[model samples]
Target: MMGTKLQVAVIGGGAAGLCAARHLLSRGDRFAPPVVYEVSDSVGGTWIYTDSVGTDRHGLPVHSSMYRNLRTNLPKEVMAFPGFPFGPHLPSFIHHSDVRRYLEEYAQHYGIGEHIKLFTEYPLPISSSSTRSRSRTLKEEDQKSYHPEEVAIKSFTYIIIRNRHYSDPYIPNVPGMEYFQGQVMHSHEYRTPESFTGKRVVLLGAGPSGIDIALELSQVAQEVILSHSRPPIASPLPGNVIQAPGVDRLSEASVLFQDGTERRADAFILCTGYNYSFPFLAEEVGLKVEGGVVSPLYKYVVHTRFTSLCFIGLCKAVCPFPHFNCQVLFSLAVLDGSCPLPPERELNAATAEELRARLESGFPARHFHKLDSLQWDYNNELAQLGRFEPLSPILKELYENCKAIRGRDLINYKSYNYKISSGSSREWSLLCPQ
Candidate 1:
């Protein structure tokens, strides 16, 4: 209510941070212009950081650079911003570059680029010796190691953005792999079908990427063998299902099957995805991973102990991340007193654990959160804090559409489902995931 300006620090200039900044600005009288710290020179986070290793049909960079066949899993309707609707000429499921362009346009349209301080890395703040000194002034002995930047100040509120890049491919130690005289590369390094032309390729993992890569290679490679310990759940999309005979392990440039069959390969593509790594908070933050499951916070946003700092864009179950980011911004605004703070106990431990367990149980254990369930939880908390509003008719209609096609309870929606559906089916499923 006072005229004093509130200083808010957003650590990451990616989609989540930009959204939060916009939300804070929207609350005209609540806070000052937010400070956004971006380590990269450009606006696109991972998209800008990763190099183009692949190309599209028009010779444009794919993935971030050149990722051919890389399409957004979400529908354009739900994925697009509220005001600046997606162009009608674009496909329902557009390529990744389109998404990047949209992000750039959103940033420019909202004037968020001005607030972002690019190329600034955020290290943990150091403790000040002055705060610990018994005397008002410290002697030269205490001043020897003291630095002004080391001091922790309480002037600004901080929010951390978290995301895992698909670059780090998981390569399990396989016997005789080192002896193999063939080319071996992780999915991150993979760019185009030209690299595997006329080569016998052994593709690993059964996830979406693996399946897609194998399908691509099958066209150019002399023969493509998909090696997996267990059968992959076929993507729900309609297509010719290719199942390579099961293989037990890789050995001497060849795949050895459980039943004693073997086939040589000229190249091996590891389509295994990334592991969740938080080098910044792995030690200082008490994150616990038991039986390959990690749960570091309540509702995957707020730390149970350190409530001042929150994590945005960490949910694996969500798609069209802007939706979840908006919810997070709303929550953050409530915390900042620009709006009302949600009740502390709306997201119960039991529910959070159940959600966590279900996500971590898949073959590749990708996390997925249901849109309606998350919105419900978010709205309930907002209601307790007196900041709740019913979903707009458009959002409500989208939610019902998503629920009807999935046939699963809205409380249990997951991201993997999006990967399975065809363009048309996916278009029909347009709810915002948490």
Candidate 2:
């Protein structure tokens, strides 16, 4: 027996939300068309560049993390979603503007703009007992709760999007930090280097943002120190940049390192990363996060306790478009009753087992949500279970190869172009500068 059409609600009209709407619409009669809610006045979420950083005219915190000079680290070939190729004339590596234009074109080509409600925000779920109650809490002239007509379209509905985290950037606690007289700010507050052109800057953390910011600031800052707990960076750094051990404490005007070294800097930037947050989800949902990771998500998409509540594009360090494609299709299949899922207890056990293995393998608690090397296998499993085409093998091979090159030549890797040519079903070649 066929179930009633599901009315899916997609949150945050970014890459993931856009893909979800496209797939749900393509499913035709099986599902009611998806309604996308976007807080911003446009379809692109983080891709929409805004000069405003702290807050907008409406006092909402800015969500875009893109810097003015930022360009994609990955090639256009792999970045593009399946069946939607980037312009052939464009270079393999492109600027952020190009990506924004591409997303706009995608929305227009698929007629997704009409289905999206720009500037409309949905309230977080209340609770399982009153998930359907029509209660009015927050009032807004433009924003609103789901309408009866929309909810009545289907007996089941689901929404999927990546979690928002930039509203509150994480900062590590260090003794005497309160006495620091110099400027202290999170990387989320940093948009450009114009203000710090002649100042010495200390950046915490050595993740991608820290490395990229160090390089960016080296061009302007008098001195840039990348302080991190990890081993020294492998790539050559700019002349103005230096590496230092993790910070031990901060004195009024300087920082003391664990190695008994101290340096006074004009400013400190906490590139320590962000915390997982869902402002709209109710407290009783039990979607708790510990050590920067969300828990009890079966296959990292469906909630083990409530399978109807799913999350897509939650994994880190992946080919986002292809990954979203697999996840959305798999989730929709499950909702449509085509894919048989195990009991809730079994699903919860599976998630626990995976988390245990990852921790036992020496991965830190912070890396619980990271799917860097394991993403390919995970995507394949979703595709197999949902009976959809898995990501091309070339995608995995090229992604791994590019990561190595980036680490070795961080300064010049983006200068080269790449092309993927497939000769047979499984045979492919990645063409790049030798």
Clashes of each: 11, 1
Over 136-223, each residue of candidate 2 has an lDDT whose tens digit, in order, gives 2222453333221222221225656556554568877878878988889887777788888999899989887788888889999999
Q: What RMSD does each model have against the real structure?
A: 9.6, 3.6
TM-score for candidate 1: 0.70
Evaluate all candidate structures by whole-model CA lDDT and list the values in order: 0.55, 0.78
Q: With candidate 1 superimposed using the best TM-score fit, by how many Å does residue 340's alpha carbon deviate from the native? A: 7.8
lDDT of 1 by residue, 1-434 (tens): 54575556666666677777777677557677776765445576544434445433323223232246566544565566555666766755567678778778878888888887654544344111111211111122332322122322334544545443343345677667787778988777666788778888887776546766776677677787776766544435223223455556677678776668888888877766665555435354565444334554555566544455566665543444545455665556545665533444544464466664666764333433333436544544534443545333344445445546444331233332222133533333333445
What stretches of model 1 exceed 4 Å from their correct place?
Answer: 1-5, 49-69, 125-155, 165-167, 229-241, 245-247, 258-260, 289-292, 337-348, 351-434
Q: How high a TM-score does candidate 2 get?
A: 0.91
The clash tally of candidate 2 reads: 1
Candidate 2 achieves a global lDDT of 0.78
In model 2, residue pairs whose N, Cα or C atoms come closer than 3 Å (at least 3 residues apart or on different chains), thus clashing, are 124-280
Evaluated at residue 284, the lDDT of candidate 1 is 47
